[model samples]
Target: MNEWLIGLPEDQAVFVARVAIAFVVCLGAVIGSFLNVCIYRIPIGQSIGKPRSHCPSCGRMIPWYLNVPVLSWLILRGRCANCKAPISVRYPIIETLTAMLFLMVFQMWGNPAIFGLVRLQEPLLIPVYWAFAATIVVNSAIDIDHGILLDRFSLGAMPIALALSGFFPGMHGESVWTQGLIDSAVGLVGGFAGLWIIGLIGSLVFRKEAMGFGDVKWMGLFGALFGWQACVFILICASLLGAVAGLVLLLSRKAALCSAIPFGPYLGASALIWLFWGPRLLDWYVSLIVPAAL
Candidate 1:
């Protein structure tokens, strides 16, 4: 732990931690508010930047104070102040989840050098990651609801991912801009082609669509940001998680074995895990398997 994180006495440490937690919570809430826009607009073919948020039921533009993330929902009793129409709990939940992810990313990389070098210092990165996560969340949710991943959300994320990976030193192994470009290109090719091949083979054998194009593009985005190896790890982890989830759903009679399950959420979840814990998990897996092989 950093001295600043641990230098305090036990009582003081608790206070410090609480303050940090509160800051993270506030950040998450704000990001969550924006993510709501992305979620609603991306699917409906609306411009996220052009339209100001309004009550879906009444079309009343939300006032600043009334749009204060989770607090607004609570204060309004989960109803729109303008029309008294019940608000979806999804807003608060998304906001809170966004905040938690932000805090987790902060805690994972505490150094200013890493943050600064990786473009983490920018306010935009916070929302960027939130949007990235939101893309996965929205896609997964919609897929679960309707058995499809919307192209607009998944495809829209590619350029943003490319731009971030291109400039961020931590995302690319080398600090040089050129190397970052190369890494990103390699990542994109590796990610897309790898999954596309798998999808093709699976479809040929099963005589149906085994994987969607949205998933291919999603993996490519992950690769462009995280690199080819992390993309592979993400794919493996997602496959494992999806398989287990699918089995559970089937055995419980919640879904038929043939039912199409959205693999995007698992990919997103695995990508996040890889982002934070990739090295540690890799080492642990190597340790386990190497010893067995030896």
Candidate 2:
């Protein structure tokens, strides 16, 4: 696959790659628009599909023209065309974020295999990673808004993750189904227990609930997908992120010392970092330290 691209003239290859990326961006934004629907409707128990997009203020059904992802929001000036109600800027932001994330995934997995001169690897991971990215966005947004992680997204994803690992053993850096399943199961148990113990210690130290059970389950889902090393990386990275965020909040006087902050979003962010650069970052750090030790 990549050989064809490599054989093309450099100018033509660049044009072809740009065209492919542009298409991916458009598709991502469209999917993101649907994700916005999922984020809004899931919490309220509304059917995301049956009811067409509508203005919440005036109950006006949005036409196709008014529903074209980020562009429509800009054209309408962040207001509903019918009632002139102020629309949240979050719509465009979500669309943009999804578009960018999708592009990154394409660059990471699709570029070498389909667009560039590099060797082709697993092309199937492109769609898998996209789905993973969307899941993170939806669940993170819901957690930010509701302060609760839905079991449907967290615990519900565990079996699916395990199944994927078994089917695509390459996900776990293995070629055999049994080894992949074993690694996934180990990570799952490690993720759950690791967070549970940390939560216990935090409660003891803070004399209050310091972690939500939802976060534990969320970590388990990631573990099932990525394996034990990723679980450890996510745990460390998320804790640092949470600590930094908590410090900023405290300094700004926006929250009390004991106020509860949702942790799922941090976990989601950490999962993404792991997906993109965790292994490389870990290797870099190890190299620095190992040389010094020796």
| Candidate with the greatest lDDT versus the true structure | 2
Tens digits of lDDT, candidate 1, 128-208: 665566566667666655566776665666676677766774566667777877888788889989999999999999999
Model 2 clashing residue pairs (backbone) = none
Q: What's the C-alpha lDDT at position 228 in model 2?
A: 86
All candidates: TM-score: 0.77, 0.93
Tens digits of per-residue lDDT, candidate 2, 1-294, equal: 567877888888888888999999999999999999999999999998978998899999999988999999999899999889999999999999999999988897776735452323376778988988999999999988888888998788899889889898878889999999999999899999999999999999999988999999999999999998999999999989988988898888976742555889899999999998877888898999999999
Q: Where does candidate 2 stray beyond 4 Å?
A: 113-121, 256-260
How many clashes in each candidate? 1, 0
How many angstroms is residue 31 displaced in model 1 relative to the true structure, after the best TM-score fit?
Answer: 1.7
Model 2 residue 5 distance off true place after TM-score fit, in angstroms? 2.6
